[model samples]
Target: MNDEPKSISIKDIAEALNISIGTVDRALHGRRGVSEKTKTRVLKTAEQMGYKPNLAAQALKLNRRISIGVVLPKHISYFFDPLRAGIRAAAGAAMGSQISLEFHEYPRIGSGDIEALEAAHARKYDGLIFLPGDIQRFSPLIRKISRSGTPMMCVGSDAPDTGRIGSVSAHAYISGSIAAELLAHKLPRKANVAILTGELSTLDHAEKLSGFAATLAIQAPHLTLMPTLEGHEKPKEAYRQALTLMRQKDRPEGLYLSTANSIAVIEALEELGLLGKVQVVATDLFQDLATLIKSNKILATLYQRPFTQGKVAFENLVAYLTRGNLESPVVQLAPHIVLRSNLPLFASRISETDEGEPESDSLE
Candidate 1:
């Protein structure tokens, strides 16, 4: 007979304001040690959201500290750093002092992901979050972890067949399709376009390559698709291969760097004096990439929103762990296209504040 709205709690208020629950509790109770500014904001938000505190539920939730393990790559700091920030930001806002995050970092994607993953699995934390370098290689272990009744959240990439709970990443296929369409319109004279990817073995990279090829064939038949180059996400290898590709007699007129490792490839283009000559669509954004986009050296970039991905992955994993929110197993966020005209909008967020190392947040 009664169908009414659920009462708002301190957690909801904390999440809305992106602050700790303890701070909200302190502010709402007129307790000492909370800033006046924060107290005023909390009161305003509580009144606006129609807060009805449940003291018993708040005390019960605060008694348990959830331990979470985060495993991600260390090589590509440009993308992974913001991702770490996002996770930390989410944990701080939602769980406050009731969460313990143990971040484990490996050398690169393919190099040490498995070892770190296995070690994290051994710990048997409340939930696990990681990026899968090779889906096949990670599937068995992920399946085992899943069988152990642990929830795992994959970020940046996915192991679909594995028994992991879910994933949060960019739309890899759409990212490639956007790049192909951009290049097709940029170069309409039956020119050659090449894709420089990290490793096709990875699902994300393979999907991007496939989408680019399929779209290029359908949208621009005049343009020839060159053999996809794999850099293994190594800076030196990418630079060397880029140099070799650019120096070829029949070099591509357009290039799609489908990984965040564009600086080295861009450097190679600069060395070969092909910055303006060749149209480039890079993946992800950084300060240098923004400058290049502004100068017309790079036509545009696909902003993958690594910070948002990390934040979403953490939030989703926590939700599933606490409330069994497993409605969507895979969460794919759309990519943003950044061009010369709109480079200023992302300039502030792309600025590097720290070294972007996940090891800094380690529990050990």
Candidate 2:
């Protein structure tokens, strides 16, 4: 009686193809109960008639909804905000279609963090997105997620051993290397440079430092880089620590920071009235810092694509769910360079040369 061609139903297909309902059902499930010839004939006819399964109706009949879980730290990260916006946009686009999404925030990986992660992951979500804070300590948690048979994506960090289904992380070593190379090009030949950072593990602090050092060796051999100062990735705390370094008499001409709490450091520079005295470069972008770049309070920043990450992660999950490609490939979306000259083209171009290619420093 109902004539809605928009809805593809099993009953509709069976009736149109003049097949018994039982035969169609068995063909749909690939049941061993049906004869091989009947199964092939029924499926061929269904395909020829443009038969399509309704995920929503199927889920209702089977009593299982496609669910996805996302985990993130609750700290005030300027990058995460935009990333969240992208994630919501991507998920909302898929709403009332196939999947349901849930978001969980844990401020840090503390005493009960593992328990919390486990509990949230225990839900029968089809997939997961995680910002893994500390990989070494969180290895067990990662393993647990892997064993749960749900595809997992690691954003901001690469968790290779944990069976991460995909990753969308910045090329940290290359970002830091670019800062060093660019600073050399912009500054005086003998100028001294210094670096400030958060904990080395979380921000890929060590890898960035390696890039900076390597780039410095080839492009600005005469330049000097002071010892790295740990800033704890907090604005006020980093500002306080930076005060001592900023006041030093033969202060470095370039200040490099690969940090999570860069706002305070920039403010500290302003307070010292040394805003333009030292060129500064950092790892991520913020609204205020982009303003500073236009005003020349900061020199350059290597921008990572968090928004693209959310989109890619969701796509990975969707592919795994509908297609049954359970072991989804690990994908790393490239990073971007954000300078005052070009904030508009944030994630357009490739940030660095691929790691596989043999590259030697060139002073251009």
Candidate 3:
């Protein structure tokens, strides 16, 4: 009465099919020299036999190590910390596969991002997973890296026009539309709405704004739209901008935060005694933002699944390096809207952090 599960082996499949072991190996691995008919037969037989490749054993047999570099912005810890944790967790799970992840943090945007990209290139890592600050600005570098035959995967943000291998992120435009749709059902008629975001040059932020504006136009035309306030990914900057916007005679009745600086915006609203008065829709979930949503101060916040994005980005790059499989050109994760009713369920999973490490203005 053995309780251990039985393992399927290639040799067993080959013997059962009365085919040479070499032929079975080539067909199973998708290598050249295997006829399509034979390949199909091998796959069908393998599936019937419940064949599962021993990834660790395969890695040991190869006797090779895959090195990947991760470049991300550390300016906002609430978002990127969970992402980093996910990458580390995935790397730990792949311990026997000999995959190493080297992390490098840069400023949220500008020349610092370029310098980090350059440093990553100089290191000649086997692969790269990065969050692009500005696609147009980094197009050339991205192209150069791709032309060098190194695989690159974009995380959180994408450089689609560039020759990067793939991307993993939330559906930016759809997320924006969700925010607009949520606000439309909650806000008063003829309410004024304003958006606070990071740089518009970045693809992610720009797409979010575009989606939000389009959805609002269709679903909530009564809500007045105001010009965007650029926060530059800084809490203090966002606080100042939020304060200034609220002071105006035509202060916004609804606020949409397209970046991860909701804490600053909430603080500003609290200071002006408008925390519960003005409806708010924010992006990403941190402990503070979750608490705000639970208290009904912030209307709702979108959870982008940053941790899963990081893990997928690393896994995709590793797959390309080891098996030459690019799962897809872009992998967009769906976002979940968290409101007061659902805050308790998501509270334990929130990326709880008071503050991130200090950031510098320039790359050192």
Candidate 4:
């Protein structure tokens, strides 16, 4: 083992520490092992070198097919459509992977524990792509899987310790920055902003708010966003909160929510007949919102490609499985602005592919 940490294998320790391979092997397995003092030395040396068990090698030895199970937040039209498309594109590109992928969707993200747990049973796969629940609770399980050599990836939001693990998602903080810009340009002066949020314990929620507030401090100095109203990740519930906010004497000019479930906000604004007045900005680009954009209702939106997210994850796993390329330990797609006038610019029109050219990704 080197002084600086290394991903040492048994052979490395045998050579570097000048111990016999048999001694090193016995030390590792504890099979009537070596002398306690020698075992301790070997173990200490291995730990100091950052030696980790190789799960991929074992899977290959066991002749396990490389498969990844993808967990998503329901097959709702908003995130699913594009994410599914990206999955297909990525899957096609991962020919060397020789792997299969499956998706498990959960409808009740904010509340349903039973259904979510049941969906975790991916009997045929080797790795996972998780759209996680509460990070404080779910992180340990994710970590445990990673320790066991499963290449776990997450999109949308993630838990703590995600840096050492795997991810293919957006810079949520940048998304918030974009939202701040959208709000800044729409409003003539700085005013109160209201954000509908879910459990703040989630990392994405925290980072996004941080990004929004920090950027607002610099860009829209007069803007004062109120304390978060728990939207419970339900659009209908968010709508109710929007109603209450609209009733306030000092109503906010900007309304931002970090969920695909912010459909409630629209309905709420519609109910108060103040949909036009409230500068609504959020994280989803659903078909109805697209329609509304055409009519000049939605000012702008922040888009993350969930499909590309899923596809990239699959491609990564397959590439690792087939080509042994492990350099890409993390993936970050860029964030883009989608305004009403240029909404069509982002259209992942299936027909666009027939023109013998790739579609434009604005963030690129």
Ranking by lDDT: 1, 3, 2, 4
Q: Scored by CA lDDT, what does every candidate get?
A: 0.84, 0.68, 0.80, 0.66
Compute the lDDT of residue 22 as modeled in candidate 3: 83
Lowest summed lDDT over 10 consecutive residues: which window, candidate 3? 355-364
Compose the digit string of candidate 3's lDDT tens values, residues 1-364: 3232344567778888999978988998899998999999999999998876645335534786767899888868878888887787778877555776799988676648889988998998888899887777888898889767667899888887677878988888988899888889988488889989988888889999999999999999998889998888878989999999999999988888998867888898999999989989999888778778888888998877778777787877776665444536588877878889988767656764322221112101
Best by lDDT: 1
lDDT of 2: 0.68
Whole-model alpha-carbon lDDT for candidate 3 = 0.80
Model 1 earns a TM-score of 0.80
Segments in model 4 whose C-alpha atoms lie over 4 Å from true places: 1-64, 113-124, 162-164, 322-325, 349-364
Model 4 / residue 231 / CA error / Å: 1.3
The global Cα lDDT (0 to 1) of model 1 is: 0.84
TM-score of each: 0.80, 0.73, 0.81, 0.77
Error of 3 at 172 (Å): 0.7
Candidate with better TM-score, 1 vs 2: 1
Error of 2 at 204 (Å): 3.6
**lDDT winner, 1 or 2:** 1
Q: What tens-digit string does per-residue lDDT give for candidate 2 at 1-364? A: 3122232346666777687777778788887677888788778877877665544335535756677788776564565655565566678776455577887876543334466567778786767777766567776677767655666777666666665555666667787788898799788579889888876655356668888988998888988988888765556768887888888887788988886468788788889899867889877766677677778778888766666666666766665555434343555444466787786654332222111111122111
